[model samples]
Target: MNFKGILLFISLGSSFILSFFLYRQWSLTNWFDALFLIGLLLIMVYCVMVLIEGQFFTAFLKSTRNFFAKVNKKDQLIRESEKRSVEPLDYRKEFPNRSSFLQVGLFFCIGSLLISSALHYLN
Candidate 1:
């Protein structure tokens, strides 16, 4: 319905379509091309999803800053009890209510691709 949902739908559809075409091509030609194209498609979909959501960059920056702050604090040799006092990063706060459907679809596509490839190789 929304932009993210639309992108997810496009990505999932492309994954299925590409997998079908890649399998056909692999049967006729080579496996390397199919594998490369699969990887490329996955990367493209990932980039589009991440950029559209605009959270990856924000999460990365936040994690980096948190890491440095922890490192600096550790250098001060704080007590173990004090170390435990530092609050952990709350991923839920960063990206609340993230959809799992896209992840499930992506993983399903990847799993099918790998299983098919393995079967082909075994044969």
Candidate 2:
């Protein structure tokens, strides 16, 4: 129930409705055109999601890396008495409740498409 979920629902639902209308109105005249339009809409959605996901993950990883890098030891210990080891970043553990919304958004898109297809078939 995040913003991405709401937006995806609206976007997918609108496209599905528009596709249905095209199918009903012009399908007989140019069935391939209707199909092509629907396919293009789906592809566009897929590409947008991919781009968003890529940018989100890339920025997330970079920030995490930078956070660790900023705290890193710049100088090595030359003397045993001055030895101080910088702790390694524990990225092996997952961030609490992080990026769950993005996955939920992806699921929302899938669910919307399935529901739209079901309704379309019923009609």
Candidate 3:
């Protein structure tokens, strides 16, 4: 696991515990609020990870600039060399393991909700 993945797991694990408590105390009265709070926490964790790694943020800015440059719709004479050359697309390079972090976080959130529901029923 990368640094981001580790951070995600830690945050999600703690959130799961907190969520369980909220579910027990509030009994679904604040389910949406809890979900929103957890989403914000996850976003904050991602922002911290981005700050620590730094590469993803820089790549995001670079890719945005490239996208705008390509989308300008300006007509220019194509050079022979540029016509012959093709840029390779590797999504992994652009995203930098973001999918895994999302997947793990999503799974943890769902699992926590289920567990909380089960506990509520069992009580």
Candidate 4:
């Protein structure tokens, strides 16, 4: 299978396994609860994946560095030094499959929600 398909399968399988363990060992009480928990977990994963895809951490670091440089009265020097340095690494080129996390997280979230809804309606 392709990377996206593999990611989706792994996410779905892991979510099921995790939810099953929670239902068995914790106070989940039912498959519905477990599925709901899986939905939440997958949603969190989706958000984190989105952040990563957006390069939020990189931007945050850049802003923090600027803030510190400004506080030190060396913003211009820092900017000039950065311009003279080698080009920053292209993360997308380095990790070409990283974007697949967004789709996998989304698919897992939606699947968990749908299953949980069905369980709710059936019971």
Candidate 5:
């Protein structure tokens, strides 16, 4: 398996193990609760991963800086000078294959929801 596939396997396994322990600790009789919680957790992680991959915060900061720069011409000049001195960092290099994370999270979430629904009806 490729590196991403291995990582995905590890993440899914860890999440299941963690949720299983949590389920036992909480004294829950139903497996549905554990699965549901795992699904939600994975989905949330996927959302965070996507946000970081997209550099949403960096864009937000740039816009905020621009707004402040417009309000003060002096500050804008200083900001321009700083920008010229600094090189733009490639943030994408830090996180590769973000779609894999999204897919894994969604798969777990949807699978859990379906299983929970089945269990609910069966019970």
Candidate 6:
């Protein structure tokens, strides 16, 4: 599975585990309390998933660094392109798919938050 898929699985799994622990301590018998705990765990799960999968974000960043490491220095671009597999310097000239890492992540987070909030309200 991809990192995002792994992250999603980890997030859901950890939330359930935490909910289990809270269930035992606070209200083992009450279904509603258990459910509420589960719902609350979503925030924690997001936090943990972000922590663990931060490396993926780092990887994306490293890619961007590779991309920008050539910016304004076309002199070195040709040389750097020779050393790397991705040819980041050529990409800006050819494809120009210039989406920044932060913009992509902000989009993802906004989407995820919306979906999670909707699910919370529905549940």
lDDT of each: 0.54, 0.50, 0.57, 0.60, 0.64, 0.48
lDDT of 6 at 7: 43
Candidate 6 lDDT tens digits, 1-123: 755455445544554565567655533233334334444444455554554454445556667877676564874666677865444322211212222223333444555456656767887
TM-score each candidate.
0.29, 0.28, 0.36, 0.49, 0.57, 0.26
Q: Lowest-scoring 10 consecutive residues by lDDT in candidate 4?
A: 85-94
List RMSD in Å for every model shown: 10.0, 9.9, 9.1, 5.4, 4.8, 12.2
Candidate order (TM-score): 5, 4, 3, 1, 2, 6
Tens digit per residue, CA lDDT, model 3, 17-97: 666777765444255346546655565555666665655466676677667656654422242336642243333324366
In candidate 1, stretches whose alpha carbon ends up further than 4 angstroms from where it belongs are 1-43, 51-105
TM-score of 4: 0.49
Better of 3 and 6 by lDDT: 3
Candidate 1: clashing pairs of residues = none
Cα displacement (Å) at residue 92, model 6: 23
Question: Per-residue error at 123 for model 4, in Å?
Answer: 2.5
Per-residue alpha-carbon lDDT of model 2 for 1-123, expressed as tens digits? 975556456654555566567666534223333433444555565555656544646657767766665555453323224664444334333333334434544454555556557667888
lDDT of 3: 0.57
Total backbone clashes of model 6?
0
Candidate 6: list runs displaced more than 4 Å.
25-123
Candidate 2 lDDT = 0.50
Quote the lDDT for 72 in model 2: 54
Question: Candidate 4 residues 21-65, lDDT tens each?
Answer: 765654323544554455455556656766776776886766666
lDDT of 5: 0.64
